[model samples]
Target: MHLERLVFILEVVGQKGRATVADICAQSDLPKPTAYRLVQDLVSSGLLESPARGSFAIGKRLRRITLSDYSDPALLEVIAPVLANAASAYGAAFFLSRLRGHWVEILHVATPETGVSYLHPGIGKRPLHACSCAKAIAAVSPELLSRDELKGQLRQYTEHTITNREDLAAELEAIRAKGYAECVEELERGISSVATTLTKTGAGSTVSIGATASVRVFTPATRNKIGKALSEMSQELSCALGWNDADAERICA
Candidate 1:
Protein backbone atom coordinates (compact mmCIF):
# COMPACT_ATOMS: atom_id res chain seq x y z
CA MET A 1 0.00 0.00 0.00
CA HIS A 2 2.85 2.41 0.79
CA LEU A 3 4.61 1.79 -2.52
CA GLU A 4 1.35 2.11 -4.43
CA ARG A 5 0.48 5.33 -2.66
CA LEU A 6 3.95 6.72 -3.32
CA VAL A 7 3.80 5.86 -7.02
CA PHE A 8 0.29 7.30 -7.29
CA ILE A 9 1.38 10.56 -5.66
CA LEU A 10 4.43 10.80 -7.92
CA GLU A 11 2.24 10.22 -10.95
CA VAL A 12 -0.11 13.01 -9.90
CA VAL A 13 2.79 15.43 -9.37
CA GLY A 14 4.32 14.42 -12.68
CA GLN A 15 1.04 15.05 -14.47
CA LYS A 16 0.35 18.38 -12.83
CA GLY A 17 4.05 19.37 -13.07
CA ARG A 18 3.41 20.29 -9.44
CA ALA A 19 0.61 19.36 -7.10
CA THR A 20 -0.81 20.09 -3.68
CA VAL A 21 -1.77 17.47 -1.11
CA ALA A 22 -5.39 18.36 -1.70
CA ASP A 23 -4.97 17.72 -5.38
CA ILE A 24 -3.61 14.28 -4.62
CA CYS A 25 -6.34 13.49 -2.12
CA ALA A 26 -9.05 14.56 -4.55
CA GLN A 27 -7.61 12.72 -7.52
CA SER A 28 -6.57 9.52 -5.79
CA ASP A 29 -9.42 9.42 -3.27
CA LEU A 30 -6.76 9.02 -0.62
CA PRO A 31 -7.56 10.05 2.92
CA LYS A 32 -6.17 13.41 4.05
CA PRO A 33 -4.02 11.83 6.70
CA THR A 34 -2.58 9.31 4.24
CA ALA A 35 -1.86 11.92 1.54
CA TYR A 36 -0.25 14.42 3.91
CA ARG A 37 1.99 11.82 5.52
CA LEU A 38 3.22 10.52 2.17
CA VAL A 39 3.94 13.98 0.77
CA GLN A 40 5.78 14.95 3.93
CA ASP A 41 7.94 11.84 3.77
CA LEU A 42 8.72 12.39 0.11
CA VAL A 43 9.72 16.00 0.77
CA SER A 44 11.90 14.97 3.67
CA SER A 45 13.65 12.35 1.53
CA GLY A 46 14.31 14.88 -1.28
CA LEU A 47 11.90 13.07 -3.62
CA LEU A 48 9.76 16.19 -3.57
CA GLU A 49 10.00 19.82 -2.47
CA SER A 50 7.34 22.20 -1.33
CA PRO A 51 7.97 25.46 -3.09
CA ALA A 52 4.88 27.07 -1.63
CA ARG A 53 2.38 26.23 1.07
CA GLY A 54 0.55 23.03 0.01
CA SER A 55 2.36 23.02 -3.36
CA PHE A 56 4.91 20.37 -4.31
CA ALA A 57 7.51 20.34 -7.06
CA ILE A 58 9.94 17.68 -8.08
CA GLY A 59 12.95 17.53 -5.78
CA LYS A 60 16.65 17.24 -6.58
CA ARG A 61 16.56 13.44 -6.45
CA LEU A 62 13.76 13.24 -9.02
CA ARG A 63 15.33 15.90 -11.19
CA ARG A 64 18.54 13.93 -11.34
CA ILE A 65 16.75 10.70 -12.06
CA THR A 66 14.68 12.15 -14.89
CA LEU A 67 17.26 14.67 -16.15
CA SER A 68 14.51 17.23 -16.15
CA ASP A 69 14.86 20.26 -18.41
CA TYR A 70 13.97 22.63 -15.62
CA SER A 71 16.94 24.75 -14.56
CA ASP A 72 16.14 24.93 -10.86
CA PRO A 73 19.03 22.72 -9.79
CA ALA A 74 21.66 23.99 -12.19
CA LEU A 75 20.48 27.61 -12.27
CA LEU A 76 22.48 28.88 -9.31
CA GLU A 77 25.56 26.84 -10.13
CA VAL A 78 25.66 28.03 -13.74
CA ILE A 79 25.24 31.65 -12.65
CA ALA A 80 27.51 31.54 -9.61
CA PRO A 81 30.25 33.39 -11.43
CA VAL A 82 27.82 36.02 -12.61
CA LEU A 83 26.42 36.60 -9.12
CA ALA A 84 29.88 36.58 -7.51
CA ASN A 85 31.19 39.04 -10.10
CA ALA A 86 28.32 41.45 -9.56
CA ALA A 87 28.50 41.11 -5.78
CA SER A 88 32.26 41.67 -5.80
CA ALA A 89 31.99 44.65 -8.09
CA TYR A 90 29.32 46.33 -5.95
CA GLY A 91 30.63 45.08 -2.60
CA ALA A 92 27.27 43.63 -1.69
CA ALA A 93 25.12 40.50 -1.78
CA PHE A 94 23.20 39.02 -4.71
CA PHE A 95 20.43 36.41 -5.03
CA LEU A 96 18.33 34.39 -7.46
CA SER A 97 14.59 33.74 -7.29
CA ARG A 98 11.94 31.80 -9.20
CA LEU A 99 8.17 31.65 -9.71
CA ARG A 100 6.84 28.16 -10.26
CA GLY A 101 3.16 27.25 -10.57
CA HIS A 102 1.80 30.19 -8.55
CA TRP A 103 4.42 31.50 -6.12
CA VAL A 104 7.87 33.03 -6.14
CA GLU A 105 10.67 32.30 -3.66
CA ILE A 106 14.39 33.02 -3.30
CA LEU A 107 16.63 30.13 -4.32
CA HIS A 108 20.18 31.24 -3.48
CA VAL A 109 22.37 34.14 -2.38
CA ALA A 110 25.91 35.32 -3.13
CA THR A 111 27.77 37.76 -0.95
CA PRO A 112 31.05 39.61 -1.27
CA GLU A 113 34.07 37.81 0.17
CA THR A 114 34.66 40.74 2.50
CA GLY A 115 32.66 43.92 2.72
CA VAL A 116 31.05 46.40 5.05
CA SER A 117 27.63 44.78 5.10
CA TYR A 118 24.53 46.11 6.79
CA LEU A 119 21.71 43.61 6.08
CA HIS A 120 20.95 40.43 4.19
CA PRO A 121 17.54 39.29 2.91
CA GLY A 122 17.80 35.72 4.04
CA ILE A 123 16.80 33.07 1.52
CA GLY A 124 13.15 31.85 1.51
CA LYS A 125 9.86 33.66 1.06
CA ARG A 126 9.74 37.38 1.82
CA PRO A 127 6.64 39.53 1.83
CA LEU A 128 5.67 39.97 -1.82
CA HIS A 129 4.74 43.62 -1.32
CA ALA A 130 8.19 44.44 0.08
CA CYS A 131 10.55 42.17 -1.86
CA SER A 132 12.30 43.39 -4.99
CA CYS A 133 12.98 39.90 -6.32
CA ALA A 134 9.38 38.77 -5.93
CA LYS A 135 7.98 42.02 -7.31
CA ALA A 136 10.22 42.01 -10.36
CA ILE A 137 9.01 38.58 -11.34
CA ALA A 138 5.40 39.23 -10.37
CA ALA A 139 5.29 42.47 -12.34
CA VAL A 140 6.08 40.71 -15.58
CA SER A 141 4.04 37.62 -14.71
CA PRO A 142 1.08 38.68 -12.63
CA GLU A 143 -0.29 35.16 -12.63
CA LEU A 144 2.56 34.24 -10.31
CA LEU A 145 0.90 36.35 -7.65
CA SER A 146 -2.27 34.27 -7.84
CA ARG A 147 -1.13 31.94 -5.09
CA ASP A 148 -0.46 34.93 -2.85
CA GLU A 149 -3.22 36.71 -1.00
CA LEU A 150 -2.99 40.23 -2.37
CA LYS A 151 -6.34 41.80 -3.07
CA GLY A 152 -6.47 44.10 -0.01
CA GLN A 153 -4.47 41.78 2.15
CA LEU A 154 -0.92 42.84 1.45
CA ARG A 155 1.46 42.21 4.33
CA GLN A 156 3.26 45.28 5.65
CA TYR A 157 6.76 44.16 6.52
CA THR A 158 7.88 47.71 7.28
CA GLU A 159 6.40 51.18 7.29
CA HIS A 160 7.84 51.69 3.83
CA THR A 161 6.17 48.56 2.45
CA ILE A 162 3.30 49.16 0.10
CA THR A 163 0.11 47.83 1.65
CA ASN A 164 -2.46 48.99 -0.87
CA ARG A 165 -3.29 46.76 -3.82
CA GLU A 166 -3.74 49.71 -6.15
CA ASP A 167 -0.42 51.19 -5.07
CA LEU A 168 1.24 47.82 -5.59
CA ALA A 169 -0.26 47.65 -9.07
CA ALA A 170 1.13 51.10 -9.86
CA GLU A 171 4.52 50.11 -8.54
CA LEU A 172 4.46 46.99 -10.70
CA GLU A 173 3.61 49.06 -13.76
CA ALA A 174 6.63 51.21 -13.04
CA ILE A 175 8.79 48.14 -12.70
CA ARG A 176 7.54 46.82 -16.02
CA ALA A 177 8.41 50.13 -17.67
CA LYS A 178 11.80 50.49 -15.97
CA GLY A 179 12.73 46.84 -16.58
CA TYR A 180 13.70 46.40 -12.92
CA ALA A 181 12.43 46.83 -9.35
CA GLU A 182 13.94 48.38 -6.23
CA CYS A 183 13.27 48.11 -2.51
CA VAL A 184 14.40 50.94 -0.26
CA GLU A 185 13.89 50.20 3.44
CA GLU A 186 10.74 48.32 2.58
CA LEU A 187 11.61 44.79 3.67
CA GLU A 188 13.95 46.13 6.32
CA ARG A 189 14.63 49.59 7.71
CA GLY A 190 18.22 49.90 6.46
CA ILE A 191 18.41 47.24 3.74
CA SER A 192 17.80 47.89 0.04
CA SER A 193 17.71 45.64 -3.00
CA VAL A 194 17.32 45.84 -6.78
CA ALA A 195 16.00 43.12 -9.07
CA THR A 196 14.83 42.32 -12.59
CA THR A 197 12.96 39.35 -14.06
CA LEU A 198 14.46 37.26 -16.78
CA THR A 199 12.53 38.20 -19.87
CA LYS A 200 12.54 34.56 -20.80
CA THR A 201 10.24 32.01 -19.18
CA GLY A 202 10.74 28.25 -19.04
CA ALA A 203 9.70 24.99 -17.45
CA GLY A 204 6.42 26.54 -16.39
CA SER A 205 8.18 29.12 -14.27
CA THR A 206 9.67 32.64 -14.40
CA VAL A 207 13.10 33.47 -13.00
CA SER A 208 14.42 36.67 -11.39
CA ILE A 209 17.80 37.80 -10.11
CA GLY A 210 18.88 40.66 -7.85
CA ALA A 211 21.36 42.23 -5.47
CA THR A 212 21.03 43.60 -1.93
CA ALA A 213 23.02 45.89 0.32
CA SER A 214 22.82 48.62 2.94
CA VAL A 215 20.51 51.56 2.31
CA ARG A 216 23.36 54.01 2.86
CA VAL A 217 25.53 52.23 0.27
CA PHE A 218 22.66 51.86 -2.19
CA THR A 219 21.95 55.55 -2.59
CA PRO A 220 20.02 57.17 -5.41
CA ALA A 221 22.93 57.08 -7.85
CA THR A 222 24.00 53.59 -6.75
CA ARG A 223 20.42 52.36 -6.90
CA ASN A 224 20.04 53.27 -10.54
CA LYS A 225 23.40 51.74 -11.33
CA ILE A 226 22.59 48.46 -9.59
CA GLY A 227 19.13 48.31 -11.11
CA LYS A 228 20.46 48.71 -14.64
CA ALA A 229 23.20 46.17 -13.99
CA LEU A 230 20.66 43.63 -12.73
CA SER A 231 18.48 44.20 -15.77
CA GLU A 232 21.40 43.41 -18.04
CA MET A 233 22.26 40.37 -15.97
CA SER A 234 18.68 39.15 -16.29
CA GLN A 235 18.96 39.31 -20.05
CA GLU A 236 22.27 37.52 -20.13
CA LEU A 237 21.04 34.80 -17.80
CA SER A 238 17.90 34.31 -19.83
CA CYS A 239 19.83 34.05 -23.06
CA ALA A 240 22.17 31.48 -21.57
CA LEU A 241 19.21 29.31 -20.63
CA GLY A 242 18.41 28.74 -24.32
CA TRP A 243 16.02 31.67 -24.56
CA ASN A 244 16.54 34.77 -26.68
CA ASP A 245 15.12 38.27 -26.67
CA ALA A 246 12.82 37.30 -29.53
CA ASP A 247 11.42 34.39 -27.54
CA ALA A 248 10.56 36.64 -24.61
CA GLU A 249 9.20 39.34 -26.86
CA ARG A 250 6.86 36.90 -28.52
CA ILE A 251 5.62 35.65 -25.14
CA CYS A 252 5.09 39.17 -23.82
CA ALA A 253 3.35 40.18 -27.02
Candidate 2:
Protein backbone atom coordinates (compact mmCIF):
# COMPACT_ATOMS: atom_id res chain seq x y z
CA MET A 1 0.00 0.00 0.00
CA HIS A 2 2.80 2.39 0.86
CA LEU A 3 4.66 1.58 -2.34
CA GLU A 4 1.51 2.16 -4.39
CA ARG A 5 0.93 5.47 -2.59
CA LEU A 6 4.49 6.56 -3.20
CA VAL A 7 4.22 5.67 -6.88
CA PHE A 8 1.02 7.72 -7.19
CA ILE A 9 2.62 10.74 -5.54
CA LEU A 10 5.70 10.53 -7.72
CA GLU A 11 3.62 10.26 -10.86
CA VAL A 12 1.49 13.24 -9.95
CA VAL A 13 4.42 15.54 -9.08
CA GLY A 14 6.48 14.30 -12.01
CA GLN A 15 3.74 15.50 -14.29
CA LYS A 16 4.74 18.98 -13.10
CA GLY A 17 1.51 20.77 -14.03
CA ARG A 18 -1.14 18.14 -14.50
CA ALA A 19 -1.81 14.63 -15.72
CA THR A 20 -4.65 12.18 -16.25
CA VAL A 21 -4.93 8.92 -14.31
CA ALA A 22 -3.89 7.01 -17.38
CA ASP A 23 -0.86 9.24 -17.77
CA ILE A 24 0.10 8.66 -14.15
CA CYS A 25 -0.34 4.90 -14.56
CA ALA A 26 1.85 4.90 -17.66
CA GLN A 27 4.55 6.86 -15.83
CA SER A 28 4.38 4.67 -12.72
CA ASP A 29 4.51 1.30 -14.61
CA LEU A 30 1.49 0.25 -12.55
CA PRO A 31 -1.61 -1.59 -13.62
CA LYS A 32 -4.51 0.66 -14.57
CA PRO A 33 -6.70 -0.81 -11.81
CA THR A 34 -4.13 -0.15 -9.09
CA ALA A 35 -3.35 3.34 -10.40
CA TYR A 36 -7.05 4.23 -10.45
CA ARG A 37 -7.54 3.03 -6.91
CA LEU A 38 -4.50 4.91 -5.59
CA VAL A 39 -5.41 8.06 -7.46
CA GLN A 40 -8.91 7.96 -6.03
CA ASP A 41 -7.50 7.49 -2.55
CA LEU A 42 -5.06 10.38 -2.94
CA VAL A 43 -7.76 12.68 -4.27
CA SER A 44 -10.08 11.78 -1.41
CA SER A 45 -7.28 12.42 1.07
CA GLY A 46 -6.65 15.91 -0.39
CA LEU A 47 -3.17 15.00 -1.50
CA LEU A 48 -4.10 15.46 -5.16
CA GLU A 49 -6.65 17.57 -6.95
CA SER A 50 -8.61 17.19 -10.17
CA PRO A 51 -9.05 20.56 -11.78
CA ALA A 52 -10.49 19.21 -14.99
CA ARG A 53 -12.49 16.14 -15.90
CA GLY A 54 -9.50 13.75 -15.93
CA SER A 55 -6.47 15.93 -15.20
CA PHE A 56 -4.97 15.54 -11.72
CA ALA A 57 -2.46 17.83 -10.05
CA ILE A 58 -1.00 18.61 -6.67
CA GLY A 59 -3.72 19.65 -4.22
CA LYS A 60 -4.14 22.59 -1.89
CA ARG A 61 -2.89 20.45 0.96
CA LEU A 62 0.37 19.80 -0.87
CA ARG A 63 0.68 23.50 -1.65
CA ARG A 64 0.07 24.40 2.00
CA ILE A 65 2.91 22.08 3.01
CA THR A 66 5.36 24.57 1.46
CA LEU A 67 3.72 27.65 3.01
CA SER A 68 2.41 26.32 6.30
CA ASP A 69 3.70 28.95 8.71
CA TYR A 70 3.57 31.88 6.34
CA SER A 71 -0.18 31.87 6.74
CA ASP A 72 0.22 33.49 10.14
CA PRO A 73 -1.42 36.92 9.93
CA ALA A 74 0.22 38.18 13.10
CA LEU A 75 3.68 37.37 11.84
CA LEU A 76 3.00 38.96 8.47
CA GLU A 77 1.58 42.19 9.92
CA VAL A 78 4.46 42.63 12.33
CA ILE A 79 7.17 42.06 9.76
CA ALA A 80 5.66 43.94 6.83
CA PRO A 81 5.86 47.39 8.37
CA VAL A 82 9.37 46.78 9.58
CA LEU A 83 10.56 45.90 6.06
CA ALA A 84 8.71 48.85 4.60
CA ASN A 85 10.21 51.22 7.13
CA ALA A 86 13.69 49.97 6.43
CA ALA A 87 13.29 50.39 2.69
CA SER A 88 12.07 53.94 3.13
CA ALA A 89 14.69 54.89 5.66
CA TYR A 90 17.64 53.61 3.73
CA GLY A 91 16.30 54.19 0.24
CA ALA A 92 17.22 50.59 -0.51
CA ALA A 93 15.44 47.30 -1.09
CA PHE A 94 14.31 45.23 1.90
CA PHE A 95 13.33 41.58 2.02
CA LEU A 96 11.63 39.21 4.48
CA SER A 97 12.41 35.55 4.04
CA ARG A 98 12.22 32.24 5.89
CA LEU A 99 14.28 29.11 5.65
CA ARG A 100 12.18 26.59 3.69
CA GLY A 101 13.54 23.10 3.29
CA HIS A 102 17.04 23.46 1.80
CA TRP A 103 16.38 26.96 0.50
CA VAL A 104 15.45 30.42 1.75
CA GLU A 105 12.27 31.69 0.12
CA ILE A 106 11.66 35.41 0.07
CA LEU A 107 8.09 36.11 1.11
CA HIS A 108 8.04 39.89 1.03
CA VAL A 109 9.97 42.85 -0.32
CA ALA A 110 9.77 46.65 -0.15
CA THR A 111 11.18 48.67 -3.01
CA PRO A 112 13.18 51.84 -2.65
CA GLU A 113 11.41 55.22 -2.71
CA THR A 114 13.72 57.07 -5.02
CA GLY A 115 13.28 54.37 -7.70
CA VAL A 116 16.88 54.93 -8.79
CA SER A 117 18.09 51.32 -9.08
CA TYR A 118 16.07 48.46 -10.47
CA LEU A 119 14.34 46.50 -7.73
CA HIS A 120 15.13 42.81 -7.52
CA PRO A 121 11.78 41.55 -6.25
CA GLY A 122 12.56 39.32 -3.31
CA ILE A 123 9.97 36.60 -3.96
CA GLY A 124 11.93 33.51 -4.95
CA LYS A 125 14.36 30.81 -3.92
CA ARG A 126 17.90 31.53 -2.66
CA PRO A 127 20.67 29.08 -1.87
CA LEU A 128 21.18 28.52 1.87
CA HIS A 129 24.97 28.76 1.72
CA ALA A 130 25.26 31.91 -0.39
CA CYS A 131 22.48 34.38 0.37
CA SER A 132 22.83 36.87 3.23
CA CYS A 133 19.35 36.12 4.58
CA ALA A 134 19.81 32.36 4.34
CA LYS A 135 23.25 32.51 5.94
CA ALA A 136 21.84 34.59 8.81
CA ILE A 137 19.18 31.97 9.52
CA ALA A 138 21.60 29.08 9.02
CA ALA A 139 23.95 30.69 11.56
CA VAL A 140 21.50 30.03 14.37
CA SER A 141 19.65 27.00 12.98
CA PRO A 142 22.13 24.15 13.14
CA GLU A 143 19.65 21.92 11.38
CA LEU A 144 20.37 23.83 8.19
CA LEU A 145 24.02 22.87 8.37
CA SER A 146 23.55 19.22 9.30
CA ARG A 147 26.55 17.22 8.11
CA ASP A 148 24.32 14.52 6.68
CA GLU A 149 22.43 16.82 4.34
CA LEU A 150 24.88 19.23 2.62
CA LYS A 151 28.27 17.88 3.59
CA GLY A 152 30.53 19.50 1.01
CA GLN A 153 30.80 21.45 -2.25
CA LEU A 154 29.43 24.87 -1.44
CA ARG A 155 28.88 26.74 -4.69
CA GLN A 156 30.36 30.18 -5.27
CA TYR A 157 27.90 32.75 -6.57
CA THR A 158 30.55 35.38 -7.11
CA GLU A 159 34.26 35.99 -6.63
CA HIS A 160 33.70 37.12 -3.05
CA THR A 161 31.38 34.23 -2.12
CA ILE A 162 32.51 31.90 0.66
CA THR A 163 33.15 28.46 -0.84
CA ASN A 164 35.17 26.77 1.92
CA ARG A 165 32.99 24.94 4.41
CA GLU A 166 35.32 25.63 7.36
CA ASP A 167 35.52 29.32 6.60
CA LEU A 168 31.75 29.44 6.08
CA ALA A 169 31.28 27.70 9.40
CA ALA A 170 33.45 30.24 11.16
CA GLU A 171 31.61 33.09 9.46
CA LEU A 172 28.26 31.68 10.51
CA GLU A 173 29.49 31.42 14.11
CA ALA A 174 30.49 35.06 14.01
CA ILE A 175 27.07 35.96 12.64
CA ARG A 176 25.43 34.09 15.50
CA ALA A 177 27.50 35.96 18.05
CA LYS A 178 27.02 39.37 16.43
CA GLY A 179 23.35 38.75 15.53
CA TYR A 180 23.68 39.68 11.84
CA ALA A 181 25.39 38.89 8.53
CA GLU A 182 26.66 40.99 5.68
CA CYS A 183 27.58 40.42 2.03
CA VAL A 184 29.74 42.83 0.11
CA GLU A 185 29.08 42.04 -3.54
CA GLU A 186 29.20 38.39 -2.64
CA LEU A 187 26.02 37.13 -4.24
CA GLU A 188 26.02 39.67 -7.05
CA ARG A 189 28.82 41.77 -8.37
CA GLY A 190 27.47 45.23 -7.47
CA ILE A 191 25.02 44.44 -4.69
CA SER A 192 25.75 44.77 -0.98
CA SER A 193 23.40 43.36 1.64
CA VAL A 194 23.01 42.83 5.40
CA ALA A 195 20.63 40.47 7.19
CA THR A 196 19.61 39.29 10.66
CA THR A 197 17.78 36.16 11.70
CA LEU A 198 14.85 35.86 14.11
CA THR A 199 14.02 32.57 15.77
CA LYS A 200 11.41 32.84 18.47
CA THR A 201 10.51 30.28 21.14
CA GLY A 202 13.55 28.14 20.34
CA ALA A 203 11.54 25.72 18.19
CA GLY A 204 9.78 27.74 15.50
CA SER A 205 11.28 28.26 12.07
CA THR A 206 13.82 31.07 11.67
CA VAL A 207 13.03 34.18 9.63
CA SER A 208 15.30 36.93 8.32
CA ILE A 209 15.19 40.49 7.09
CA GLY A 210 17.63 41.70 4.44
CA ALA A 211 18.40 45.13 3.10
CA THR A 212 20.36 45.66 -0.11
CA ALA A 213 22.10 48.58 -1.73
CA SER A 214 24.40 49.27 -4.65
CA VAL A 215 27.99 48.66 -3.64
CA ARG A 216 28.78 52.26 -4.39
CA VAL A 217 26.31 53.43 -1.76
CA PHE A 218 27.05 50.70 0.80
CA THR A 219 30.05 52.04 2.66
CA PRO A 220 31.32 50.38 5.81
CA ALA A 221 29.64 52.99 8.01
CA THR A 222 26.31 52.59 6.23
CA ARG A 223 26.52 48.80 6.46
CA ASN A 224 27.17 49.09 10.19
CA LYS A 225 24.15 51.32 10.68
CA ILE A 226 21.94 49.06 8.60
CA GLY A 227 23.19 46.01 10.41
CA LYS A 228 22.41 47.68 13.77
CA ALA A 229 18.88 48.57 12.66
CA LEU A 230 18.27 45.08 11.28
CA SER A 231 19.51 43.54 14.52
CA GLU A 232 17.11 45.68 16.59
CA MET A 233 14.18 44.96 14.31
CA SER A 234 14.94 41.25 14.38
CA GLN A 235 14.98 41.33 18.19
CA GLU A 236 11.64 43.16 18.30
CA LEU A 237 10.07 40.58 16.02
CA SER A 238 11.63 37.80 18.05
CA CYS A 239 10.11 39.32 21.20
CA ALA A 240 6.71 39.46 19.52
CA LEU A 241 7.11 35.75 18.74
CA GLY A 242 7.82 34.99 22.45
CA TRP A 243 11.60 34.70 22.59
CA ASN A 244 13.01 34.79 26.12
CA ASP A 245 14.98 37.69 27.54
CA ALA A 246 18.25 35.83 27.25
CA ASP A 247 17.59 34.91 23.64
CA ALA A 248 16.68 38.50 22.92
CA GLU A 249 19.81 39.77 24.63
CA ARG A 250 21.98 37.33 22.73
CA ILE A 251 20.45 38.43 19.44
CA CYS A 252 20.45 42.14 20.23
CA ALA A 253 23.76 42.36 22.03
Best by lDDT: 1
lDDT of 1: 0.75
Superposition error at 121 for model 2 (Å) = 5.4
Off by over 4 Å in 1: 1-68, 100-102, 115-118, 145-148, 200-205, 245-253
Residue-level lDDT of model 1, residues 130-218, one tens digit each, is 88988887787766456434555477778999987778889988988888899998878888889887773443226788888788888
What are the C-alpha RMSDs, in order, of all predicted structures? 7.5, 7.3
Each candidate's TM vs. the true structure? Answer: 0.70, 0.68
- Candidate 2: misplaced stretches above 4 Å? 1-74, 114-121, 200-205, 243-245, 249-253
Cα lDDT listed for each candidate: 0.75, 0.71
